[model samples]
Target: MRTGRPRQFDRDEAVRQAMHLFWENGYDATSLSQLKAAIGRGITAPSFYAAFGSKEKLYKETVACYLHSHGRVTDALWDDTLPPRQAIETTLLRSARMQCETGHPKGCMVALGVMSANSEEHRHLLAPLDTARARTREGFIRCVKRGVENGELHAGASPDTLGLVFNSFLFGISTLARDGVPLSIIETSVRQIMALWETFSVKNGNELPNG
Candidate 1:
């Protein structure tokens, strides 16, 4: 008897499943067999190829899914209505909480993406993640500049340097989260980190509280 079309599945759900595997294992580390198993037992090699074209294509799709979803926590850094300091604090707190939250992989895909493929041959595959990291770093610098422009920070504050302080801390959060550090501790540390910026803050042409 002639075979009928294979039963269909939820593409979004498949992608989400694949994304978690990639998040936890990294691209180079995760294999086609693992992806097929994670996506669903029914997804044979041919079906997998038909659905996603190739492993590289599927990996790129997962990256897009990640950026659109879990990666959005830092978007607070780009919000203009909140005071620059508040924006920075919100981004840090949000990202920390998210990286530590249940129901998803610990840590950030963007932060861990680089570790996915260390070999030069696969390095180009992670360009999107590299660009995302750069964008977040730029967001920090932009927020610092906004603070300085509005006198929220002292005139002597260096946006490049100050932003690096926050950016570096933000990047480190992923490692801490992955290492099973408690969210509460990270949050407490965030407060201290914010205080570091407060030391340079000003209000009404005078040194701000904690300055």
Candidate 2:
């Protein structure tokens, strides 16, 4: 008699399901049972261990997956080709649209992870999220610096402060999105936020840092 083959499951789908669960309930709340249940075809404990090694490992995988996919929306921030204003606006509007989309979970996983970072385990697991956020903030800062260099934003405008404002707003948007705020309203709010940048025009650009 020929030896029988062990049943196989879709690992990619498993990570996707795990991503949604983590995004919905956060890091510490999601249980092993939940992960097993969420994964398609229902994997056994042995198979689960064999497939993922452990929950922490699986969480790392899911986070990486999230970054490569949904997280790319913010990548517009780093696009040097886009004008400074357009780059910032694109990231804001695109992030809002993604957070409010019908499919998958609402809100950004990275932002959600940051907010739910209460436990040490979460903090450790959230290294990638932290890096991603820092990258986003850096992107904003780069845009402001570029704007200054090109005379688009005038001179002596503090890049750090300007970048923080948008970064703070971007994270706040995740909270609003998770709170059921509609996309259209958020989009309008983004435009209003951009108007704040316009106020920092070349007219008052050379103002001191205290201003």
Candidate 3:
């Protein structure tokens, strides 16, 4: 009987494990040795290099995986079916919940992973994080513009101002989640902050949707 050889390691699972290490320690703080240890199954340094090229390359892959998986919730910002306010609210609430999940590192991977880039190499590895944040701001701006166009917001409202405020609030929530704030408290805070959105809305008895 000829039996095929067993796979060396689960590549997808290895990437996920490495993602958690990077999420916990950020770029410069994480090390190749730490990554090798985390990947487990006796993955050697040569094996790590063969599988992922370099530490920077692996981190990039890990970030992509994280965004594609844990960060997909923010895609709601582009969902035209949802009212602008609802889309923004859904993104914040979902982000808060994901940040506080028990099994993963606290706070957002994108928000926390790129805070202290110590070198050009580190910053280069972190470019995607910056792009993600920029996209988030842009998405909020588009949502605000949609609100104005849909008659949900005042015609003279500034999308840039509203987008900045909400984007800052969302990032602040990520910091708060990392600082150990409970999800319930964060959700309550979201409700209060969203009330401010209603004050800017068009004056036709429109109300912010209750969660």
| Clashing residue pairs found in predicted model 1 | none
The C-alpha lDDT values of all candidates are 0.90, 0.87, 0.85
Q: Residue 23 in model 1: shift from native, Å?
A: 0.7
User: Which candidate number has the best lDDT?
Assistant: 1
- Point out the higher-scoring one by TM-score: 2 or 3: 2
> For every model shown, what is its TM-score relative to the native structure?
0.93, 0.91, 0.90
Q: Candidate 3: worst 10 consecutive residues by lDDT? A: 202-211
Q: For residues 1-211, could you state the per-residue lDDT of candidate 2 as single tens digits?
A: 9754474778998999999999988888899999998887577888888889999999999999999999999998989899998999999999999999987899999889865557865578899998999999999999888888887785777899898999999989988998999899999999999986776667554444357
Distance from true location, Cα of 78 in model 1, Å = 1.2
* lDDT (Cα) of model 2: 0.87
Clashes of each: 0, 0, 0
lDDT of 3 by residue, 32-100 (tens): 888888885567877888889998888889989988999786898999999999999999999999999
lDDT (10s digit) by residue, model 1, range 103-136: 8899999998879988898888899999999999
Models ranked on lDDT: 1, 2, 3
Model 2 backbone overlap count: 0
